[model samples]
Target: MAFLVDITSHLNHLNAQLQGRDQTVSDLFAHMNAFQRKLVLFKEGFSFSHPNLAHFPACEEMRRDVPECNKTFHKYRADIETLQEQFKNRFQDFYAMQPQIALFTDPLSATVSEQPPELQLELCELQSDPFFQAKGNERGILFWRLLPESRFPLLRDFALSMASMFGSTYICESNFSTMKHIKSKERNRLTDETLFHLMQIGCTNIDIDIQSIVHLQERPQVSH
Candidate 1:
């Protein structure tokens, strides 16, 4: 139970880190990579002979009460190994795009010669430009958006494509929750068109102009 608690705590921490809005692919990948490294540390810590429970506080507490706790270390190590494999398999596509991601995230430092022939000249020019070099510290999306379309069209387009990608299913899941609430048993009779309009209002962040809308409505004539 202690092992389960410790493992689940780590998993929950990772899941929390991966959530939220406006997260770019590179940002999410960075979190995943960090977790993968931590998994390696976890596997190492679970060695049978000399267990290192520094990260597993719950297990560490259990060890204080049960002297033979180290005997179960191998089982925990096996579970960690299995999890590590699963992560590797699940994010293989991300691993394959590492080079492109690096280029998109840090174009100034990317190897110009190694890039596609069409982009090589633009990359060299971009890297040499003092203006862009100064703005290199900005977020990847902003940095790419700032690039002159006439000068770095290909590179900017590539960066924009990468930036536009959804890092996780958070947005979709949130929208689904909103839809479910909107189409609940109480409002089950809502037509598709009505539901669509309601969803638009519910999901959008744009503020509706209530006063302007009220004024737009025709008022009835008053008799003296």
Candidate 2:
């Protein structure tokens, strides 16, 4: 819902901006339509002067972008449909588990009136969670906790939440690379405590002396 709402809000802002920009954008739109007609005529093997082919960058760019835009729209719509299907399933399961969780949590005080309506529904879902049911071996690291995202339905659903968002794993890999840099052959002879301290300092954005932390008492301090 937030994703859809944000997209709608931004689109409204864009429409409003264009409305106040006089007829500049409107004239460009009209010109583009004319350009498209010319391109279609060219594609039909009609003869055109050399000047026509020379300035087709705008036309060429539009040609390339149109197919990509269609693909992007299809993917966005498909994702929305998939989310709706999953939410519908989770919504039903949430209500069905209400009685069970209420019984387990408390019987006489189990009525919906005793709790916030949405919270009661969410608590019921988490308590009877298929993911948090403590079969860690069957699941994995992701299913180990539920309180972290009690508002969400299942661990699978929470994991799928950012499935479409992509990012570089460089930061994770950089931690390993930095640790290796600190533990070079010349500086390899160190206690476990010292090695751990050095690795931690190297991986973080902060620039501090690992030896100073490990040997704090021995270091000289300036008089305040």
In terms of lDDT, which candidate is strongest? Answer: 1
* Model 1 lDDT per residue over 14-95, tens place: 9998898778899999999999999999999887586899999998898898879767776788899999999999999899
Q: How accurate is candidate 1 locally (lDDT)?
A: 0.86
lDDT of each: 0.86, 0.43
RMSD of each: 4.4, 19.0
lDDT at residue 170 of model 1 (Cα atoms):
96
Candidate 2 similarity to native, TM-score = 0.26
Q: RMSD to the native, candidate 2? A: 19.0
Clashing pairs in 2: none
* CA shift of 163, model 2, Å: 14
